[model samples]
Target: MSTVFLALQTNEDTRPIIEAILQDNPGAVVDEQPAMVKINADGRLVVRRETIEELIGRDYDLQELQVNMITMSGNLDQTDDEITLFWKS
Candidate 1:
């Protein structure tokens, strides 16, 4: 299996997003850079809307991730509830 990764700017606003990622994908590996954070996972990674809402105590839009996301690698699948990235094996 290949590793899929996503890079996002490191900032206070992104903190909860990172937390939600960690909660949703237990296998995700985080790389904290000078001003960015990168998360890597084998095969798949998912971001759930409800989890973000819970983390920030407010509704969230998965599209908000794009505001901080610098890059990503994988096939992206999205819905009202989640955003998923995976390599088809």
Candidate 2:
């Protein structure tokens, strides 16, 4: 399977967001860099608003992810509830 990745800035706001991604995507691997965190998965990665709200104990908007997003790989599908990345094939 092809790998997919999402990279975000490392900071107080993104910490819970990163945790939510890991909880939602099994087998996802996290790589921590000096100022960023990269998450890699075999074929897909998902970020859910509910999971982020649960982690941080407040409501969250999925679009807020764009603030910390550095880069990503895969076809993207985004909705009010979640953002998903995966290979088309």
Candidate 3:
């Protein structure tokens, strides 16, 4: 059990995409913040810098997964999992 703080733009479709990702990886919990989504999961925690880029890779335009910022903070260990996210809506 590890905690991963994900900061990304929000949209109606984004939720489903995130859900699918979480589903793929069990033991992952998704929490919604003001304008961010917190994902606490197990296994190797990967901080993909180009998450949004790869998410909407070569689609209509580079605007679908327009992630203004992506950062991970707080403890990221299997033993203790906790994350805090800050964003504006």
Give the clash count for each candidate.
0, 0, 0
lDDT of 2 at 66: 94
Top candidate (TM-score)? 2
lDDT on C-alpha atoms for all candidate structures = 0.93, 0.96, 0.46
Instruction: Give the alpha carbon lDDT tens digit for every residue of 6-79 in model 3.
Output: 45545664664465445444655777778777665543333322342355453322233345335554443321
* Each prediction's RMSD to truth: 0.7, 0.6, 9.5
TM-scores for all predictions: 0.96, 0.97, 0.45
Q: How many backbone clashes does candidate 3 have?
A: 0
- Candidate 1, position 53, lDDT: 95
Looking at model 3, the pairs that clash are: none
State the lDDT at 39 in candidate 3.
68
For model 2, where is the 10-residue window of minimal lDDT?
58-67
lDDT tens per residue, model 1, 9-85:
99999999999999999999999999999999999999999999999999888888899999999999999899999
The deviation in Å at residue 72 for candidate 3 is 3.2
Lowest lDDT sum, 10 consecutive residues, model 3, at: 78-87
